[model samples]
Target: MYDQLVNLISTLGFPIAVSIYSLVSLSTKLDELIKSVQEVKEDISAVIKYQKEK
Candidate 1:
């Protein structure tokens, strides 16, 4: 019974911890991607404006 409990704890606990870490890392990366996209949008807008002026 003790060994069974220990095994269960290790199996469930490690995966839960890893899942939480991965989610946090993914969220941070997604935020960075969004920021990069916004910057690209601004650059495109500037290019369009310059072309219109020309």
Candidate 2:
């Protein structure tokens, strides 16, 4: 019984740890992507405004 408990914890622990790590990493990457997209949007808006001035 003790051995089975240990095995179950070990089996479950690794995937949980990996999932947490992946979520954190993806969250950081998603923030960066959102910032980049916002910057691109601002640049496009600037270009459009400049063309409209002509």
Candidate 3:
């Protein structure tokens, strides 16, 4: 019974750790993507404003 408990804890622990790591990595990537998108939006707005002056 003790061996089974240890095995279960070890197995569950790895996946939970991996899941948390993945979530953190994904969150970081999403923040970078959002910043890039915002930069693109600003660039497009600038272009539009310049064209209107013509």
Lowest lDDT sum, 10 consecutive residues, model 3, at: 1-10
List model 3 lDDT by residue over 1-54, tens digit each.
668646755878867756866898999999999999999999999999999999
Q: Which whole-number lDDT from 0 to 100 does residue 51 have in model 1?
A: 100
- In order, the Cα lDDT scores of the candidates are 0.85, 0.85, 0.85
Give the lowest summed-lDDT range of ten residues in model 2: 1-10
* Candidate 3 segments whose C-alpha is farther than 4 A from its true place: 1-12
Q: For every model shown, what is its TM-score relative to the native structure?
A: 0.74, 0.77, 0.73
For candidate 3, report its TM-score. 0.73
Model 1 residue 47 lDDT? 100
Which model, 2 or 3, shows the larger TM-score?
2
Model 1 root-mean-square deviation: 7.0
Q: Stretches of candidate 1 above 4 Å error?
A: 1-12
